[model samples]
Target chain A: MKVTHAKLLAQVPLLTDLPTELLESLAKSCRFEQVNRGHVIIERHDTTRRFFFLLSGQVRMLDLNRQGQEIALAILDAPTHFGELAVIDSLPRSASVQATTRCEVASISPQDAEKLIYTVPQVSRKIMQNMATVIRNNNLHRQVLQQQSISNRLAAYLLGQLPKDIDPKETVCIRNLPIQYDLSILLGTTRESISRALTTLVDEGLVTKDGKNLYLNDIPGLYQLLEED
Target chain B: MKVTHAKLLAQVPLLTDLPTELLESLAKSCRFEQVNRGHVIIERHDTTRRFFFLLSGQVRMLDLNRQGQEIALAILDAPTHFGELAVIDSLPRSASVQATTRCEVASISPQDAEKLIYTVPQVSRKIMQNMATVIRNNNLHRQVLQQQSISNRLAAYLLGQLPKDIDPKETVCIRNLPIQYDLSILLGTTRESISRALTTLVDEGLVTKDGKNLYLNDIPGLYQLLEED
Candidate 1:
């Protein structure tokens, strides 16, 4: 892919204040690959060699138990970066990353990435800023997951999608949200708990459910649920 | 403190690589304060504007529940940085920090910290790297805490403190190690569990306990416990 294509990959908060030229240069060096669904891009404890950016589809970051139960950590969608921590810390992969769908990913080996950063200081700064945002968001998410209860966590998770001071009457479309199983893992709860919470919301008329989709019926009630003791 | 003192402070991994003059300037602006035991420096969700560096003594970072139960997250010791996350993210404090001992600390306002970072690029880079390390360590600790049983966690915790390839016959001192309560929080287990594990080790002649101190008597045994299924 041309370096111009990489320009489309940078998100606002993650790569804020970067010059277009730097991003173009970075995109030029990235090696793009198409991976099938369920393909493992990286495995836990593997040597850290490459950093990957998702161009399309979803990737799941997860850890496996000795008995082979997988605990999903985070899901990386389009325009998101992963495996950078390994490069930064010079450590082995802390978890496994696998394609949840047919994924188009661009990767830069650590050696190449470091060389680019050294040669292009602007790109390095932008990358650092991007990493800082990732760390901050991860920490905030972990904090919410640790402190909030299952129900409150579900409400907060939904509220997180809406803007602060959202209109009470505004109906929120939830069909495009990530998979329920992914949500359950991210919130550190079971799928049954998530389904039950969604059912309760629907029963209370706080949300409307149709097949696999949902829409907010009472945003105020949803907010109240989030605030409940 | 003199410029030399500031330079010495900059020797910390977080501040290393910053310009000497910038370090001197930041040190000059820092306010030195003494905190008595039980003093709260930062409160969870508090909109405080100051950040701290532990110059001497221990400071405990804790998460508080609605019922007012406190869970210790980390213990900040000499020359350690704290409160940088809140400053960087421009968010309310996520955890409370309290003095666990009569200690001297240096503090800087968020504004000044930002100014120093902007003016001294190296300082900003160092700060970013430091925060990254903290995030990585925090995640690793949480993973270990969540996955391991209390006994295994305690054993892993102890084994982590020992040097690799230590002789099985060598006695390792634990007097300077963190207090039991702090250890309990670190391992995400209870004080009773820690006590019981210690007692078991003592009974098996794998460790010796005297007053508040412990000595490792069987390094291989501790490692085996850490590796148990």
Candidate 2:
């Protein structure tokens, strides 16, 4: 069981550089959990400081305002870790983490997480790299929000979600987009605004909506919307 | 001169935990600069990867859209560092950094920065803690933006800038507030919206403004605005 857990943890992107011995030790310190869909994995402002690494499935990090409106922050797929910020800083959870789908996760106690960071060079480097990515993405998101139009922001979002290697002129059909409410929250606009943005995209012949999927009819046109007023 | 640089680096909150020997080595690798007000220290998307430690004065991290509109991200005070993200991840500058006042900064080359992070346990730990603070504050800012009201965001921004230990009932005067345009950018609103929000605050008797200063007549009232619709 310990070996199996260690092997599983070794597959995590954040822990890939960690040595086998360290992985075994970490596996010992971690408590594995099987979370059901819609489970509140970590609550906003909760004092618990455990570091969680998702083994499978997906989760969404969000915050609820005083009016109880959910603000979607990000959705995380498996093989990524969360809650390390609170664990490192000893602060309350910055936002709540909810399982968007059933998930398997491994959680480490605060002491174990601290030990790994303080004693292991690779672990600390990995954490810093991961955090740098988060901060950079957050900065980009801020830039998108400041673009001043829901359609522009939505265009940027779609471009970001698609594979980078896809040719600009090539048509691509992206499936399993988040629901309208989640998209609205992520784009920092109302659901009605999102609907209007989609209509605008459809009218411009840049995108075609088919059930849960969206097809890019003109990828360059979507980019043009972001570049123009 | 190296010893002088070491002493200055020692005072930085991020480097305070670093040992004397590491500070000496770091000082050797760092290039110091004296920047005039409005100097662009780091430009957005610049490929240069250098970690900067601010020795004195203030700098604003901002991004400019294609239309050349500025969006202020944060105003970083002295004794803190920036650009570590680019150094750690070898990414382009996430945002531009401009001196808000005459400033002194020490910069480490990408090689030296990487060496420090990889070899120094204390340095890496401190970076993680600092990044954690940045992420938490970013999360809070996102929540503030999601509040969906310019007044609520402005109030939250004011509360964040003020000293936290102040008594809620005691009237307090906060001076040297950012210019209206900068406030507008930081709160994700327009200057007109910020003016209207300020007017709303005054009409509610929660705040009073004098030229460049703001007086909080009812701190709790501002908090209540955040709590209510």
Candidate 3:
């Protein structure tokens, strides 16, 4: 089965707002490539201004913290875009991206991206909306990182993972806990620390795990952890 | 002497790209207000979508960390804008804003702002650029906050304060260190802790302070602090 470039571009959230002709034009100019796991997709401080859209598989966004330790900013899955900031604003890449799995990605030159943004109302508005989301997510990440204790940060992250409108009295089950390795990266702690924190929550009867599903037994108690020092 | 609304709008970085006629139309829809020190300008989770431009004085961006403590995210002086994220994306305010000094500001309805962004290429690009900077700064802030100790975070913050192009061998002086109260808030620590951290840096000969000016006596040594536990 062959997927047309235009079909792939149309699947992107940012380009979905674009009319068919624009998407076709974008499809024509974009360069598509596939790489195996651990291949660097983008390097930190690289000045190349290209917008990348992930069509398949996953990539890890990595940056060095002040301690020169490589920290995972995020694990981005397919049907998403990265490097738009550098393309739109001409800033150097702030973080590096490496394939976590064999991945297919498409990249468009900065000039073409800029032209589409300037001439197309839908594309411009969508760009702003997407950037707004990135800003909001980053702000939330900073708030979560500000938690001084691992368990407190873990509780906050769990609370975030739950549905926003979940009933406080309802016993909710979260089936999508990231694997221990990814959890450690997201939580900025070691695998041992993540285990310890989860145990602390389970021992306190706030959460319970059965096989792959983790149940939030006491939502209020989990919230209370965030208030503690 | 008085400032015309259009004249004020012309001074905003986002609006600088707008032509005079567009600026004038925008000015017609904006409302001006004056707030005294400590007045809450925008409450977090508030649904109101208005773009505010500070004409005078200053405001602090504040949010509650996971521990339920208010942390200062940043401070903005006059001739700046906030709330664009909410205006564009219709998200609830992510953080609150309070006047740090007596302030004058103007706000535009979301419709006018969106209209300008959709119709004006320069304005749209400027908005994206501004959002890009916000995302980058947030990334850096999260990296700094990930440091385990106050002194390490302080050192990272100090390094950030220096000019990016400063010569490594040249001694640099920073006269614009935020007031101790603000620095404490920025570093997520107590004023006493900030004092302790500074004394440690000074006593170690990495920094020297004389009155209001602080000199980076050993830039490389300061960088080394971040690599420590």
**Judged by lDDT, which candidate is best?**
2
RMSD of each: 4.8, 2.6, 2.4
Which stretches of candidate 1 lie above 4 Å from their native place? A1-4, A10-17, A65-69, A115-229, B17-19, B118-122, B147-149, B156-175, B187-207, B211-229
Residue A79 Cα positional deviation in candidate 3, in Å, after optimal superposition: 1.5
lDDT of each: 0.69, 0.85, 0.82
Residue lDDT tens for model 1, A1-229? 4645656556523343557776676677778789999999999889967977788888988875333456576777776767766776677787899998999888887987656543445555555556556555554454445334576667666765665576767787766666778777666667888888777777788878776677877777866765564
Task: Provide DockQ values for all models, in the order shown.
Answer: 0.23, 0.56, 0.76
lDDT of 3 by residue, A1-229 (tens): 1238888878878777666776777788889999999999999999988888899988888887765667778888888888887887787898899998899999988888778766778877888888888777777777777788888888887887787788988789988576676777777878889899999999999999888789999999988877776
* Clash pairs (backbone) in predicted model 2: none
DockQ of 3: 0.76
Q: For model 2 chain A, give the 10-residue run with minimal summed lDDT.
A: A139-148
lDDT of 2 by residue, A117-199 (tens): 67777778888888988887787676666556789888888887787689888889989888797788788778999999999
Residue B68's C-alpha lDDT in candidate 1? Answer: 47
Model 3 iRMSD vs. native: 1.5
RMSD of 3: 2.4
